[model samples]
Target: MTVQPNIQGQAQANPVSEIWYTRCPVPTTSGIAQHFRWIHQEFERHGIKVESIRAAADQAVRNSHYSHTQPASFREGGNVPPIWTRANGQDTVVVGITWVDEEQLILVRPDSDIKTLADLKGRRFGVPKHDTKIVDIARGQDLRGLLTALDLAGLTPADVEFVNVAGGEFDLREQGERREGRRHGVVEALLAGTVDVIYAKGAVSAALVVKHGLHPIIDINANPDPFVRVNAGTPRPITVNRDLAVERPDIVARYLAILLKTAAWAKENPTAVVKAIAAETSSTEEIVRKGYGPELHLHFDVKLTEQYIAALRKQKDYLLEWGFLKEDFDFDGWILPGPLELARALAADDAIKITL
Candidate 1:
C-alpha cells in the first residue's frame, strides 16, 4: 500500500517556530546530541525553539513519541512504532538509520531447567502485553527476539506457549517518580512462575538479570548472523514528520548534521559517551558497558547504508506479518535520503574547515 502524504490541517508556515524531538532510552546519535545540548543549541542558532515531546505535560503530546501524530517532530528510536505509524498513514519519512546491537536475551530463572533455545519448546514464554493505545513495542521486540531464537534452534512459535504478561502504561517521562516499579511487571511475572522464559534487551535488562539472577538461554547479539539480531532497536531509524522534511529541508538536514557531529564526537570519547548513554538509558556505566560492550562507542556512526536499510526492512516485514501494522506500505518509498545526504555533505565541509 502506498502511503499518501497527509499535510492537511498541518502548519502552513514555511519556517516552523519550534520543532519537537524524541528518542528512545537507548544508544542513539540523537540521544548523544541531546545529552550535550547540541540539538537545542543548533536549533537556537537558527532562531528556532526545540521542544522535547517526552517532556510534554499533556499526555496527548507525549503520545506523539509513539503515534507520530504531532507535526514538525523528529524521532530516533525503535523501528516498531515508526513502522506502525507509517503503515497507519502517519506522514513521516525516514531520514537516517543507526545500527546498534544490544543484548537481546531469552531469559529464564537461574534454577530453571531450560538451558538453551531448543529447551524452550512447549514451555511458557512471557510476552508483555503493554497497556497502550498505540503499538506495543515491547511486545513486538520480545516476539521478534523469541522467533529468531526459535528459528536458530529449529523450532517455531507453535512449539511453545505464549503467555501474555500484563504490562503497565507506556510512560515516556524521564522522572523516576512517574516510572517507579512500572517496568518490572514482566520480570515479576517470570519470578512468580507465570512464565518459564522471557525476552529482554539493553542495559536495563542486563542489570535486571544480574539483580534477579536470571539465566540467559541465548544472547542474540552474540550471534554471528546480523539478521538474527534485527529487532526493534537494532537498526533504529531517525524519522521526521513529512511537513518538517518537505517544508523545511534545511532544518531536517541541520538536525541530522548535529547528530553526525555527535556520532563523531562519541568515537573519540568513549568514557564520556558511556556516561551519556548511561544517563540517557537510566542505567549505570557498568551495566551499559556490560550490555553493549566496551567498544560501544565505535558503533555510534549513523548512515543510510544498505545493510542497515535491509535490517530495518526485515523488522518492518516482521511487524506487518504479525499484524502489528495496520497496513503494508512501500518500505523503500518511506525513506527520504536527500536530507541525510545534505547532512553528510555539511559534516564533511565542517571537517575540512576544522583542519584548515
Candidate 2:
C-alpha cells in the first residue's frame, strides 16, 4: 500500500490495494467491529479491500497472524506472539490495549483428590508444547497460569513435576476447523490420568469443564489482586506493522476509529456484545457469559493507559524470564500513541456528526 504526492509535487509511493487483519477468538474491539462488518464497510468506502490473515489460503500468509510479517496488517490477540515478534526484530507498534479478564482456572478431575492449590504439591502439572515454528503461545500462557497459581500457594516450579503434553499447531484455523480441533492435549492428559493439574481459560474451556465434569481447584479471576490474574490475554494489544503506521497512518487511524465506535456500541448493548463474543469464540452465549461474566461487554474499551502498559510490561518480563523471548527491547518505545489519539478524535467527530 502507498500514496501519491501532494500539490507540492513530492515523490509518489505505490498505490494501495488491500490491507490484512487478524484477531484471536476473544472479546476484542477489533473482533466486535469485524462482527458487525463495520471494519470492511469503512475501508470499502475508501476503495481499500480488507482481508483476514487467518482465513488466507496460503499457510505462510496465515502464519503472518502469529509472525506479524505481513505489512499493513493489524493484529489484536494474546500478548505472547506479538511480544515474541517485537523481541525478534519485527517492526510493529502497539496501538492500543484492552484488558478483559477471563476465567483463568486450575482444573482437576471431579473425583481427584486435588481440592486446593496446596494439594497441587508434588503433582504432575500439564503444560502444552505446541508443534509450531513460531512462538509457542499455549505453553507460555499455560506455564504463566500454573506458576501464578503455585506462587499463591507458596510453592514453586520445583514443587511439582511438569509434564510436556503435545499441542496443536499455532495456525488460526477457520471456526469450524477450530471447533473440530478443540481436543487440547493438556485436557486429554488430565482426563487420561497422565497429569494431575492443568490450566484452562475462555468459553470453550468453561464448556469443557461442564462436559467432562472437571472441578476447578483455583479461580484466578476471583482473586482480588489484579496482578494475580495477569496472563496472556489480560492486557491484549492491538498492533500494526510499522510500514502501515508510518506510511499510511490515515488508514491505521481510521481502522482504530471503527474499533472505538464498536467499543462504545458494546458498552450500551450487553446482550449484543455477548452474542458477538459467542460468535467470535465459536461457543454458545451461555458459555461466553459464564466464562467472561455478564459485564464483559463493559471492558472492551481500548486505550494506552498506564495501567495496561504496566500489565503488558509484566507480561513481557514474564515471557523473557521463561525463555519465550530471545532478547528484550525497549517496551515503551514499541508503543505509538499517535494512531489511537487520532482514532479517538475521529470517533468523537463522527459521534458529533451523528448527533447533529
Candidate 3:
C-alpha cells in the first residue's frame, strides 16, 4: 500500500463516500468482497465505496489499506474493538458460508458408507487450513459444543485423522502454479485413499475437486431441510463497523439499502457478475461458477434475528474460554445494526416506495 501523500484531509464523503473493504480468501474467492461489490454497483448514492480485494489472510493483515474490512471468516477470535466493541447494541453482523459436520472430512465425505453426520466414529477430520476451523465457530466457535452436538448426532474425532490443506491460495496467485504446487506436490501425499473426507467452502472444495479429482458425495443441501447458519439464520448476516455507523448514519442506511438490493440482484444475474469479476482477476469461468452459491447462497439459512445474535455472542464467550480473548465481551455493546433496521424501516414505508 503506497502512502498517497495526504493530498486531502478527511476526504471521506458526507452522506456518501468510498470505503475500501478487503476479504480473506479462505477457499478461493472472497465471500465478503463479492457480497459488497453488488452493493456498490447497484447503490452508489449511499456513499458506500467497494474494493473487493481477495488476499490470503496473511496478506490481508499486512495490507490493511481499507477503511473497514470484515473479520477473517476463520479468525482465531481476538479482543480487538469492532470485534468486541458495541454501538447502540448493533455494531456489525457476521454472515458467511459454512460447512458443518461431526468430524470434518470424515463426517462430511463425498463418497462415504455412512449415511448421516452420525455415521463416522473414530474417523479423521480435515479442513483446507486452520482458519477454516476457526470460522467453524462463527456459528458458536465452541469446539466442545460442536463436538457435543456431533456426539448427540453420533460421532467422535477421537477415532480418526486430521489434515490441513491449502490449495485455494493458488486461485489468487500471479500464476496458478503456486496453488497446483500445494495440491499436487503436498496434498496428494495424503490421498493414498486412507482419508475419509474434507470440508471447505465452495471455492476451496471446488479447487481441489477440479485439480485433484476429489468429489463431494454429500451435498450439505441433501435433506429436504434448509441449510443452517449460526449467526444470521435464514436472512444471513451483514456485520458493519461501529465508527462508520454513528458518524454517518445516512450513509450507513443508504449503503445497507444498496447492499441488500445488490445481494438480491446478484442472485438473478450471477453469470454477469461472475464474468465481470473473472475478467478483472485470473479466476476462470469455472472457478467463478463453482465459487458462486445459490442466488444468495441458498444452501445456508440466513436471517437478521435473535437466533443469529445468540450465535455471534455464543462464539464470543467460547473465544474467551479458548483464551483467544482477554475477557468476555457483551453482545449488547459489541455489535451494531441501526443502519440495517433503518433501511428496513424505509423499505417498509409506502412513501419511500415511490422513489425506490
- Taking the tens digit of each residue's C-alpha lDDT, what string does model 1 give over 257-320? 8888887778889999899988888888888998899889988777888889998999999998
Best by lDDT: 2
Sort by TM-score, top down from the best: 2, 1, 3
lDDT winner between 1 and 2, please give it. Answer: 2
lDDT, candidate 3, 1-356, per-residue tens: 12112211222443334553443322112242244344445444434455433343454432231212443111111112223333213234443212211111212333456565555465554434333312222222223323433544555656545444443322232223322234342245336544554443334445666666654434442333322222111222344555555555544454454444444444456565566444433356575456444342322222356655665565455455655455554566544665566655444452121111
What's the true lDDT of residue 323 in model 2? 97
Candidate 2 lDDT, 96-213, residue by residue in tens: 9988889988999999999888898999999999888888998998899999999999999999999999876766854653332365678889899999998888775688787889
Candidate with maximal TM-score: 2
* lDDT ranking, high to low: 2, 1, 3
Clashes of each: 0, 0, 31
* Overall lDDT per candidate, in order of appearance: 0.83, 0.84, 0.39
Task: Point out the worst 10-residue segment of candidate 2 by lDDT.
Answer: 2-11
Error of 2 at 70 (Å): 1.0
| TM-score head-to-head 1 vs 3, winner | 1
